[model samples]
Target: MCLISFFSLIFFSFFLLVMGISYLFNDFVLFIEWEVISLNSLSVVMTFLFDWMSLIFMSFVLLISSLVIFYSREYMLGDININRFILLVLMFVLSMMLLIISPNLISILLGWDGLGLVSYCLVVYFQNTKSYSAGMLTALSNRIGDVALLLAITWMLNYGSWNYIFYLEAMKFDYEMELIGGLVVLAGMTKSAQIPFSSWLPAAMAAPTPVSALVHSSTLVTAGVYLLIRFHVLLVDTFIGQLMLLVSGLTMFMAGLGANFEFDLKKIIALSTLSQLGLMMSILSMGYWKLAFFHLLTHALFKALLFMCAGAIIHNMNNSQDIRTMGGLSFQMPLTVSCLNVANLALCGMPFLAGFYSKDLILEVVSLSYLNMFSFFLYFFSTGLTVCYSFRLVYYSITGDLNCSSLHVLNDEGWIMLKGMLGLLFMSIIGGSMLNWLIFSTPNMVCLPFYLKLLTLSVCLLGGFMGYLVSDVSLYFFNISYVNYNMSSFFGSMWFMPFISTYGVIFYPLSLGMSMTKSFDQGWSEYFGGQMLYYSLKKYSLFNQIVQNNSLKIYLLMFVLWIIILLWLVFIM
Candidate 1:
């Protein structure tokens, strides 16, 4: 396993270097197509696109996968099925790679379904009821996107080819192509967990922390963003684009708000990932595809680092994930705590960090754009909420007094895990600056008022202070959570999105099914169609049999009626 990790890391690094050079000098797109079958001017072709974007993205995917695998060596050491776990992780990464390189919708769907299927397997790896339920939610939520992708592929059939890249520009304004574009956006939204589809992301934390690091950071969640970036031509200046902007903005705000209220260590990080994904989607919707992509890469670096540190902490703490039970870990595990702090601050967009470069630029671009008031508020407020949650996490997990029992021992003893985290820690600190230089040929020129320029920093500081104060025990008489229990629960529960995504979505359909079963299968159709007909036929058949028998009672009744009629006629005369 270690050998695999070492070789994979070296291979990814080499390719990343090669691709970076290619991106700088050549910047060319290479398309490979082989016709599998053709009939009547229609061709079924296997298509792969190797451009700077796809190559670089694939490199990052492999790079992160290698590190996660390295980290998992120590993390999953006690599990008897370690080999199977690693195999599943590799499969997940391969699916992501297939997704990144494919230009054809049919091929993309192959990779897309692979991701959904493997993710379900990984999510349910623990074989517990919680894992099973979470896995179901995760799989079902993603199936929506899979269905959308299928619909988009079917729409692409109208274009006479499954290669969507050929029709991206045409899809922008063509009335007939808008539906395909809309389906593409829907696909991206569900895969990326935007707005109403977001409930699965946090629930996915039931998986092993290594899976969380890989899935939340680079592979699964970001697939949607990457898809949107590819389809940006269709989204720009369109109704679907505007709707994406609104939904993504709401998602950002909702995730940030939920993160502040969450106590689970992995869950808080998961929510933070959702928030960043929202930022990426929002920028993509605004036609800043490059900026969104920039953020995506930088975010992957730090988030992976963050989750690795989280995984280490959880491993040492006997698998306790509740932040409330942790405190004063800075004394024992200085290295892990430092890495965690760096990742956290980077997430908060501290100056000179990876997150700062892309995030600040995104904010500046958003401010410069002619966006509505709602979007502007969501952007800044979500930024602040990000800081709030990070500080809250830091305080509870690192600074507060040890809240667990005295028998517990916590330390950064696992050198293997530490090595894995250290790789990402360095990248988290310097990655944004490096990527900034490589991605943007010319720096964007944005001149804004001093106060407007200061807003991002101001919000960060203000959010930090608020997080500290809100978390301080002295600030409240009762538990702060109890003061606004209902509201806190609402925010913490992600606006009841889990219920909406799982129960709410299925409730009406299932209810209607039951109603139909009762009314038709059991009631009206049962009686009126088959059973009622049988009863009617039986009654008529009995009456006919009696008539055929020519019963004496029936003959006597007929004679009596005839006599009565004759007597009446005689009386009248």
Candidate 2:
């Protein structure tokens, strides 16, 4: 099964890559439709769109999936339900593919729902309380996006078609189209783990590392970004677009801050993924969807490599995921450490690496645009925080003396896993430049001032130095003197986002429900509505029966008494 799946995925990836190149060079978009039903003037059709973007995205997805599967073969070698795991992963990839190619709202919902459901399954694959809770959080959070899509579908029905590609241009001007655009943005936010919906991304680290590498890092999280990219025409200059900009900027800043304060290795990477996602979303919201897509692709390559390296490290360290327990493994696992450093550097937008091309372009574009102070600072500061956390991570895990027990053995001899990491490592180094040349076809001339051009690099250097200093024991103690435990906890806990998303969301609704039960469902509603009506009817019925069943003797006695009283009154008058 592994062999067959691997070969098929690789073959199709190459095929799609070639097709994508052809499509891009020719400036072609092919739409194929099969009608299922027609009523009056409306038709229900299943439609597939083949364009450069979809084709290339699919190829990348397939390539990553193949490598992740190959990596998982060794990662899950002794698992009893490895087959089930593989099938779930394949289903996830299929769902993403469906979402990528469909221009129809109905079809997109089908794919969207598939992704949410399958992801929940994968999240809880380990059968533990933590996994189950994480799975539930993931499923419920994504359900919001699903509902948004459903609303979008319902709204699109008014336009007499489920295919949204036809309406992208019109939506910018039409009121209803704007509403649909808003809904789509909402959907994207939930799926991409932007703000309020952000907590689930880290919680989802409960899934196996392979799933994290393929699904969370590269594919599922980016689904929302891709959706917005497809709908960019409508969102380019609208209120919803601006709203997305503010939200995504906040998300980016929040995630970057959270990553710096985190201790768990997987959670830190997850937060980094969230940070990068926010970057893509912010760019997309600002109307540079092409740049956003570029970042998405580049991020997918390096982030996947990051996860694989983390997986290898965890595997060697007896499944210990805490970074505090790790240090100085360079001698034992040089290959993994080298790849890990490259991936981290690529993530930090080091020159010529996969992230550098896209991230640098995004920063330049953002700097040139007329943005508010909040957004401008958020972008640059977030960039710095990203470097800070990354360097801190490297410092703790690869530079200091080994912190684990002397009896422990750490090595990177798993060639099967290393093979997958190496595949992505190569891409992490060169994928950005290759993709930039192909996607742009022409260079972006950013005529920025010298200071602005140097800003991104300067922040990165400052962030790296701070990362090292902050991780130092004496410096940490010095900072702790000023920084209280609560402040540290707040930052470490993602600004209490998990609590906000779970308790903050659930608390009010559940409280309202309880109040309703006390005031209505179990209280006045029952008394006035059901119980009051029943008592009123019963009282009236009993009175009527008493009148109907009156005795004749009693009636005669009362009639005589009434006659005597009438006579006496007549005489007095």
Candidate 3:
């Protein structure tokens, strides 16, 4: 299985290169249809749509999955279920491929549900309390999206077909189509972990690092953005589109704040993923679908690389994920540190890196658009917080005093892991520029005021300063201070979203149910049925007892009266 996975990796890399080059000269598309059920005016058909977007996305998914499989070989070396792990990853990749090629809602559901179920399996693979809890949260949260998609499929019945692509262009003005658009947005939000559904992304760190890298980066999270991109044409000038813009912007801001307060290395990265997803959704909500797609592809490259680097660090650190327990590892693990720095800088939109091409373009386009003050604040503030948390992470993990009591013998020596990371490292450096040239064909023209032009750089610099001040060794002296306690707690806990999702949503409902049971089932029903029947029977027995006691004297008098009455009646007759 390992050998097969390795060969598949090479084959996919070569194939992606060939197809990417071929796409530049001539675009190709394929459509295959099969009739399923047909009545007078109703039809249900299975259809596949393969275009440049699908091909590019599928190639990247394959590339990342292949590398993840190779990396897992070393990461899961002694595991008893290594074959199951590889098979699950393969299944995940296949499901994503199915989602990419399908234009029909029903077909998309097949892939969507496949991803949700397989991801649950992967999350719970460790067979521990943490994994089990995380898996349930992940699965159930995604189930909401599955339900939304099912509703969307049902609503499409109004149009007499299940193929959404055919109607996306024509249904822009149809009022009934708003329901589908709204449902799609709701479904996308759950899958992408936006705001109310955002808790699952961080909790999902319970999965193996490779699964985190693969699922969070490209397959699971990106699925929502891809779906939105597919339906972008139908969302223009719609109320749901504007609502999505607001929600996504807030999500971006929220995730960035959460990252700054996070300590776990993997969870911090996960929060960063949430923040970037928000950015993509924000852009898509603004009707720049192509820009969102461009960022999605670029983000997948660096984020997958970032997660792999974190996995290497965690492996070397004896599975300790807390950043506070780590320091000054750059001297021992140079390659891993190098990759980490590159990926982080790329995430911050550093120039010439893969992230810069998409991220910078996104910011420029956002600036040019006419937006309200709230969105503007969110866009820039989130950008600043990204750099803030990133530098703080670097300070804790890459530089500072060696905080470990006893250092384990560590080095950047895992050949398979390094090889896997190496594949994405170069792409993280050049992928953005290559994709920009291929997708845009020409650079976007921007004419902004001087202050606006310098806004991102200035905010980034300010955030870097704040990050340094917070991480400085002297800040430890102020530990006794209760300053900003509530604020810090809020940010650290992701605004208590996990609590709200679990306790707030579940606890109150369950509490209400218990109260109802006590009031109706145990209280009212018992009183009205059992107690009332018992009391009525007791009264009847008392009446019978009184009648028996008085019956002897009353019987004799009644016999005399009865005889007299009979005599009078006979005379009258």
User: 84 in model 1: Cα distance from truth in Å?
Assistant: 0.9
Please give the TM-score that candidate 3 achieves against the real structure.
0.87
Model 3 CA deviation exceeding 4 Å by range: 20-25, 36-44, 477-482, 504-573
Clashing pairs in 2: none
Report, for every candidate in turn, its global Cα lDDT versus the true structure.
0.89, 0.91, 0.88
As for candidate 1, its clashing pairs are none
- Expressed as tens digits, the lDDT of each residue in 422-485 for candidate 3 is 9999989999999898888777888999998888888888988877777774357664124778
Off by over 4 Å in 2: 37-43, 473-483, 506-573
Q: Residue 400: error of model 1 in Å?
A: 2.8
Residue 64 of model 3 has an lDDT of 86
Q: Show where candidate 1 strays beyond 4 Å.
A: 37-42, 473-478, 506-573
Instruction: Estimate the Cα RMSD of every predicted model relative to the unseen true structure.
Output: 5.4, 5.1, 6.6
User: How does candidate 2 fare on TM-score?
Assistant: 0.89
lDDT, candidate 2, 1-573, per-residue tens: 776788899999999999999999999999999989999987778999999999999999999999999999999998988888999999999999999999998999988999999999999999999998899889888988888888888888788888889887787789998888888888999999998899999999999999999986668899999999999986677788888899999999999998988889999999999999999999998889899999999999999999999999999998999998899888889999999999999999999999999999999999999899999999999999999999999999998788887567888789999999999999899899989999999899999999999999999999999898878963556777246788878888888889987775556666888999999888998998998999999999987876677878767877999999999999999
Task: Write out the backbone clash pairs for model 3.
Answer: none
